[model samples]
Target chain A: MGKPKKLLNNPVDVVTELIDGLTAACGGDLRRLDGRNAVVRTEIADGKVALLIGGGSGHEPMFPGFVGPNLADGAPCGEVFAAPTPDLILDTLSAVDRGRGVLMVYGNYAGDNMNFDIAAELAEEVGIVTRTVRVWDDVAAAPLDRITDRRGIAGDFFVIKVAGGAAAELSDLDEVYRVAVKARDNTRSMGVALAAGSIPETGERTFELPEDEIEIGMGAHGEPGIARRKITDADAIAEEMTDRILADLPFSAGDEVALLVNNLGATTCMEMLIVARKVHHVLKARGIAVHRTDVGSFLTCQEMAGLSITLMKLDGELKRYLDMPARSFAYSRA
Target chain B: MGKPKKLLNNPVDVVTELIDGLTAACGGDLRRLDGRNAVVRTEIADGKVALLIGGGSGHEPMFPGFVGPNLADGAPCGEVFAAPTPDLILDTLSAVDRGRGVLMVYGNYAGDNMNFDIAAELAEEVGIVTRTVRVWDDVAAAPLDRITDRRGIAGDFFVIKVAGGAAAELSDLDEVYRVAVKARDNTRSMGVALAAGSIPETGERTFELPEDEIEIGMGAHGEPGIARRKITDADAIAEEMTDRILADLPFSAGDEVALLVNNLGATTCMEMLIVARKVHHVLKARGIAVHRTDVGSFLTCQEMAGLSITLMKLDGELKRYLDMPARSFAYSRA
Candidate 1:
């Protein structure tokens, strides 16, 4: 691939420029932190337990697109596929933190973990209470005994969504943290990659695979997966992936789940729907009830071609939070 | 290029299977018409002026995804990039029509115009009153004098949104048709394509371009556009596209409009945001106010890499209908 065609000015400014665009899109409801690559709600409620979500920038709607009513109060965006720096995170945390406290939720990644930890310590020094909930829901990354070693993927949407609601309604920082942790524990996701996305700065393909092969359980950034095999039918792929997720969660026959078929990047909505169809069938056959299904581009990896299936087992509390009204740049619920 | 590495079982069944998946994803709120390639709301109110929208497939989330509360009451889907047959359209029309009659909204294309017109006549013979409002919002396709010759692009979203709200609230089909016609008249759109998406049945690209070249004002199905040039910065592109759109409608300094930066298919959200940022700047500089902004994949051409900007000048009546809450598989509002 010769310099994947893109509409950009300077690759180095991708994060800042995109944040500027996102803030503009929000119609004055969001504002950027002064001299920092971060955004916060212009109307954050006083004394409300604030929800703070951040990660790399390449995943467009994830870190920033999700900042709006009933969602993250602020997001500190990082360089493409890189974690936000400690100072940037600290500024955003302080900006969104009300007198009540702040709850930080992000994917389970080493750089993000370190940076957020540092930011939390800095906030504590300044006399602001903060709590952290790292989401690790990708089952393919590690076995159940070592869940923390696994990476967080699209499951971050569920954790953030539940945490956002809890922060808005619960008022207590510890209660919000508990809700976020519960969401992370109940959510599971797996991804498959058919093609790789190009990096914004270099225009270089993230990874390469044989023309006819696909990597099952691939990471969003083209990390190695469990197996690489020739591409197969949508039904077969959905069956196998669904079975793996169901068995891993040990989701019982009567459990209810909110199903998500996330377009990793470039996969068409048609393919995602087909995969969702098969996954629903698999779930039905195994006696699992789908309380709701969301299929779209919640989290993406540039223009990489593939998708991930996420199932968040829902209880009355999780369901109430997930079903609550939300309005954001990337997601909304009636 | 080679076979496109799609996750499909049978290429010929792409439309049916996707419809199945969409209905399943709707959680029983939508159902497929018996033995027809169409879907309708399961709980349409009696004696309501029904809204029916349909068009070719390939644009996943467009026809079917828009079927739900406060949106299209039904949609008849066609094969990939092909218009639905008259029989399919008529069946869907009859299914959605209440005693108050039905209103049809769709893109302005030769095939769609012919099929929907025929379906309207067929419905008339059965005492089911029907009216049609074709969206011709692509300014790049034709000059102002020949507005009807233009192709409908992402502007269809605005038209359908207004019409869906009107049909649900207004008991008279003629009143609903008037609102839809106003929406179609006020909306304008233009698109640019960086890469072509493949057809599901045959891994064939809809169109081809040199690696570094981009096509501006291209239609959804690889239709010829007005300009082909080397890729440039997002600001320049956004400025040019927004200027052309503003000139077409002569959107005045004091006018307020709803803006949409729609991803045709594979373009990343980051790029769309950057484009949106520039468009907002241009609109502000010209003194035109944006009432609301939506950025996402509303209408797409499979996995084509490009986006379109749509502007719909809003009046009090238009704004009322546009702001109505809607719920669908692809779109939702709080």
Candidate 2:
């Protein structure tokens, strides 16, 4: 269709402009790093183990939107679908670092991993201790034997939620990192794409499919999915997605978990909720107990149409941290 | 495009299934009313002036998602884009009504107004007292002299927020009604539609427009708008929308207000944020102070592609209630 319509100006400046709008929406709770495409909390406590979250920009409310009270201490943003540069990440690292070290959490894309690692080395050179936990929760991206190869998806929210709480309460950065790793390890996600979203700069669709087909296990940024088939009802989709996630984690009977049915971008809340209903049904039949359920748009691929289901197997510590109060531009708990 | 893709089973059953899923996501904070397509808070306080909000089902998270602490006590749902029946509304009213009274707040659509009013009268016959506050916030829907004819849009959230807070805090039903009326009067909103969403049962688009054109002031259900024009950038659109809302409410330079940039489904967060930045810029230039700003999908028209800007001029009492903590399925403040 004639170049996917977008309400934007100077699309090359979308990342910066969106950051401006995001900070404005925050109402002074967050401020951008001067001359850098990054944001940090306005008031971080001294000696607090900082939690730093960052990623490419198109996924609104993921990295930048998550920076707030009881969430990430800061977020260094990259251009759309591109990882942040090492220098920008280092600058944000220094800004959010208190007397205690900072812990970096992000998706396990190669570009992000490399940039964040480089920044961590630079921070070490500056005597700022830091640890890293790359989230690889998308089971569709790789086999369980090579879990690190999987890409992070909506499960980033679960990892960030637990890590933010741990960073806030635990003085030691290592302890916070440990909890974040646990969160990442316990989470699993898989997505399907009914349609493609366009890029702001080019105004071109990211990918294309037939009118009545859907791609299962598709990555957020138009990566090829594991399977492409004709569109089906929500129950079958939900059952298949939940089955994959459950098998990956082997979430067995009586295992309480937090479930997330995240809208990829354009999927309506109605569709997500319908999927959520079937997912709950499937989980119930499998004898798994859902501790909590979240259904909304946490991470998105521009205006892409589809959704992903994420489940995080929770224990006592994870449940305590997950249930803590948080206030952010995108997510909040009370 | 090939009968607009939808993740649904038995579209006629969508309303009930979605409510089931919504209550599941609520984690025991909300439960459905027996034998009715409605939901109520599990533990509304004794002798409280209850708040009941409802409308059609397509605009999800509005009627159902907004039910929680410091929000509506219950919401009787209608089918997609259709008003709830009088019997269902009366049933929900009885379920949520405490001894004090019940306050009903909803959009000012013809069907909704008729149904809710009928229900209110029925409740009166049953020895229960109820008051109504119809939200007529769409400036494009009617002339200033005929304000009551305007259709409510995203401004429903602002009115509901104030009314919910007032109902919770005020012991007298008349005082709560006064506050809700004030909220409805102070709020104004306008929406522009880039594309249309489909009906679940028919799988047919609600309306159609040329690829390069947009309809300004279109209703959520594809009602005629004030103007149809070629696509434009965010700044021009935001300026025009903000100007209309400001002049309609006659918002003054010294007035303080809350700004909401709501997504009308399928529009990317980046676009919404860009619009928010320009709206803020426009307001700043006009010397209007924004007390708070919220940007997200509060109310949607099933996967419709567009956005709406809402302004609610605030007084001291309005500001206090607006800032109070609230938790719900779709919205939560901490």
Candidate 3:
């Protein structure tokens, strides 16, 4: 087992303790719903549309770190790598929703889709307005013809970011939902895993791959990838990952793009920056103008030593939302 | 080896490529000095005191990620875990100086002090005003009588953050230097290491420890800590770390503090938050009000799986400086 030792009590208690610690450490910016697996911003605007996003734990900052001002108003946290139950999502939506309604967004995982769908219906039964945009931006998960079937990966950051900003500024839920759908349409991503991250409870690697090799286009939760092969140079890996993601989005010459080279977990910024240079080389060679680039752990899979490259092709509308100032424990812009 | 595998090509080129990639990926916010091993904000306010911080590499977001308008005005980077050459620091000061002066700040390592001290003299000879503050806040490395000999760790974040914000708003170099000194004097930190992390160039673990144990008070670069023992509960570890740091500073009741639970590198946010809660509890039970709390990877030591806890006892003046808005590649507050 190559899995590194973890700092955890009982692995089963990881999520609950993580939430309690986060709420405590958050100063006064966040709070948890009583006896519920939901974390919400301390203050919700009176008439602003609420943005709620969640799926599983382990992907820190994805669900909880992002719940603050100028970001998601609330996060319905689930157990590690597992979807939140419908009942929990319902509780989150009801608590966060103001008169302006709510928007549910998260990765397009099967369990998440089923759970959130039911929760949305349950919300409406209580006369609360709610809509959703399940992000499907992982190009490797499916062919172009089945784009929507692709699993959501790190690109969930861009979609949720846009939705959060829009939800805060837009008066109506429809406008916020529209921006989320559009952001999802404009984003594409590809990932490569160097090692399988362990699940805290079992201390087990979710999957195994040969040493001196990496699996390109691997899903965050150890989902299948395109193939596993000998570890190549960073430039070659960057080129291949960039080529696949670029073509899927077909981000052509003259396109302006915001690129995010997200650390899957334990990959060093030293290595990520090396990869970032290769990404810039390929995109620049094609005459694409890179707009904003984020190179860090925007989303992670525990301590997986891998990275995901995500590109959000910017249009006038997407760029506007992307640039909006927001403050969260995870993502902050001044 | 517990260190996870890294992603890179020709590990010797990690630093150069990291600088290049960061320059390209920054999208206009940052740039590198021509013919110099330094990174600086693209625009420096004329006549404002320049704040420059740096040290050995591998600690991402420390030396370079903090270079921006609201943070350090510039960073002079060195080889991984090695101090920048005096010539490099001289070049950085010359390039970033906006006429007021430059403050050279970083950890109080032997190599760093020697290098920056020489650089300060060089800057003065070149007609550039310069001051220096070497953070010595690690409590485990020395007794209270020998505080000046203590190694700097995550406490560098609090010192630099206050200095940067003060430099931007303070009227002169002397004022900035005074505030930086005050902030440095008020900061303390303690860390624990669960596993060793590797250096890309050698791919060698920095140190060795038992798999089921942790070394309390370990330095960021695997420097010797207080003791190594069987793994303990998060709250217990937190209690020990907090008690030592608090007593070192004698941070008493009725004091307001800013807390930082920083991942040394690969520790999960889930675990960090759990630790954060314990840190908060320890401080709160003692009647200390945490004015602000930061729980994430501020400064890192590659892919090491561990964390450090830092506290800055904030006075009214320090709090005002810390609250000033600043934006950098890694840190942002709106």
For DockQ, the strongest prediction is 2
What C-alpha lDDT, on a 0 to 100 scale, does residue A313 get in candidate 1?
97
**Isolated chain A TM-score, each model:** 0.99, 0.99, 0.98
Q: What DockQ, between 0 and 1, does each candidate earn?
A: 0.85, 0.86, 0.74
- Candidate 1 per-residue lDDT, tens place, B46-141, comes to 999999999999998898999999999999999988999999999999899888898999999999999999999999899999989999999999
Model 1 Cα lDDT, one tens digit per residue, A1-334:
3556888879899988898888888888899999689999999999899999999989878888888888899999999999999999999999998899999999999999999999999999999999999988888999999999999899999888889888889988899889999999999999999988989999999999889899999998888989899998999998888988998987889999999898988889889989999998899998999999988887888989999999999999999999889988999998
Q: What tens-digit string does per-residue lDDT give for candidate 3 at A214-320?
A: 99999999999998999988999999999999898789999999999998888887888889999999998999988889888877888888999999999998888
Give the candidate order by descending DockQ. Answer: 2, 1, 3
Model 2 stretches with alpha carbons more than 4 Å out: none
Error of 1 at A61 (Å): 0.7
Runs off by more than 4 Å, candidate 1: B1-3
lDDT of 3 by residue, B1-334 (tens): 7435677888888888899987887778889889566898889888889999999899987889888876898888999999999999888888889999998889999999999999999888989999999999899999999988999898898898899989999869999999999999999999999987788788889998876889999999999899999997788889999999999988999999999988888887788888888888898899999998888778888888899999999998899988888887777777
Candidate 3 residue pairs in clash (backbone atoms < 3 Å): none
lDDT digits (tens) for residues B45-156 of candidate 2: 9999999999999988788999988889999999999999999999999999998989999999999999999999999999889999999999999899999999999999
The TM-score values for the models, in the order shown, are: 0.99, 0.99, 0.98
Q: In candidate 2, which residue pairs clash?
A: none
Q: Is the docking of candidate 2 incorrect, acceptable, medium or high quality?
A: high
Ranking by TM-score: 2, 1, 3
